[model samples]
Target: MPSESSTLHTPAEARVRPVQQWWALSGRGVAKVFRNGEFVFAFVSPAFLALCFYLPLSALMDVYGVDYAQFLMPIIVLQSVGFAASSAAMRASFDDTEGINTRFRVLPMPLVVPMFARLSTNAVLLVVSLVCAAVACLIIGWRPMGGVVGTIGLFVVALIVGLLLGLLADGIGLMAGSPQATSQALVFPTLILGMASSGFVPVSQFPEWIQPFVRNQPISQFVDVMRAADTGSLTWEILRPTVWWCGGLFIAAVLLLRLGNQKVRA
Candidate 1:
């Protein structure tokens, strides 16, 4: 009795009831992103991220006599995390335009599954990219003095921050209507925040005005945490600021997710 097109809906699909099968929806979310070309480059991107951006900047900082890779490691970790999150947002946007989201809406799947699953998939991808960065660090003479705890902490921060950035990117994608614009929006914050808040120079290097503003900013705090972890330097200055930065970004990401969903669904 089914229509010819209805045959395309598997029996499994019909049985995946709403609330009970949220995880199944996540699987679909994961599948959708991998279908695109993004994952193909994820494994190698850390090398590119280092060669194209982190290494060059670290080399410049070598004049300070601090280890180039050491000084740069935290910054690189944060950058990767943020960039990864932005990619997540872009992926969400892609789903919207491709009609993937529409399909999900029509199905019995839970709404949260798509976003969360997409996020989870990207998280794994970003972690792999971070590992690639770690290998690059080894190749370029960087060492992690923070030992196991610091190393773990750095990656953890990266994942959280990356997830948020992705959400932010997703929101933008909803508004901008294209991948290119989503990418630009993602890159701008990474550059501005990365350069002005940390890595390029210490907070002391900035003028008194810019110093106060960024002193408590996330990148500065993240760099401080990373700097310490990379070199075994410890300070309260880094801890408090990083907590604020993480919390703030997390809130922003959640808010953006809500806003993006509304925009896209509307």
Candidate 2:
């Protein structure tokens, strides 16, 4: 007669494949975003920013020889991307605080799968946010004059930036002591960076003392490249600073991820 253990299933038999595991978690994340009304905020935020800023400020920008609607599109789109990233941070913090991530640690899956799943969900939201921002821009009289290649480049840059920011935010969520702290930590930096950028006004409009800082900051570099791409005037010189900024963001994200993983292990 066979022993009882011989007839029972092994732990390995019960384990799911890593790919399946990743997809399942990703589906869960995406479903939560939709079910909890995150999609509604995803649509509302860019539209709100576009209407609030464009209507009152278009005439002021026109006086300075700038087309406000067109000029505001990049920053508006970027702000939506920022919102998506912030949402990712909040989700990460919730998962950690709720012990979901801790439960994930005991699962029969690769350690990186959860992170990748979160990334996939973030990507989905990022695209949705971008589309909403584009619609908002259209309503405000912004047109894509960038031609096919330049337009593609414009979105490509936004995606890259958004993903990096999302990763950074993910790390912040993992390491932050609480969800409220994560939200508080993100608020000032986003505001300071967005407002100080060359996105809304000409660099000359900034105080002469701060012009040098405003001209060379990461946000300003991104805006310059985006604006150049919009006009089909993008050149290597205009893109160099953005490349450097991407490299810095990449390094920061990697470091943050490492730190976050350490915290999780602890």
Q: Report, for all candidates in order, the number of backbone clashes.
A: 5, 0
Over 48-106, each residue of candidate 2 has an lDDT whose tens digit, in order, gives 99999998999998887888988999999899999999999998899889988889888
Q: What ranges in model 2 sit over 4 Å off?
A: 1-16
Q: In model 1, what lDDT does residue 116 have?
A: 72
Least well predicted 10-residue stretch by lDDT in candidate 1: 17-26
**Judged by TM-score, which candidate is best?**
2
lDDT of 1 by residue, 80-152 (tens): 5665667776777787888877787777565676777676677766776677667766766677677888777
Candidate-wise lDDT, in order: 0.68, 0.90
| Candidate 1: clashing pairs of residues | 81-162, 85-165, 85-166, 86-166, 89-170
Q: Each prediction's TM-score against the native?
A: 0.80, 0.93
- What global local distance difference test value does model 1 have? 0.68
Instruction: Name the TM-score of candidate 1.
Output: 0.80
Question: Whole-model lDDT, candidate 2?
Answer: 0.90
Report how far residue 194 has shifted in candidate 1, in Å: 1.8
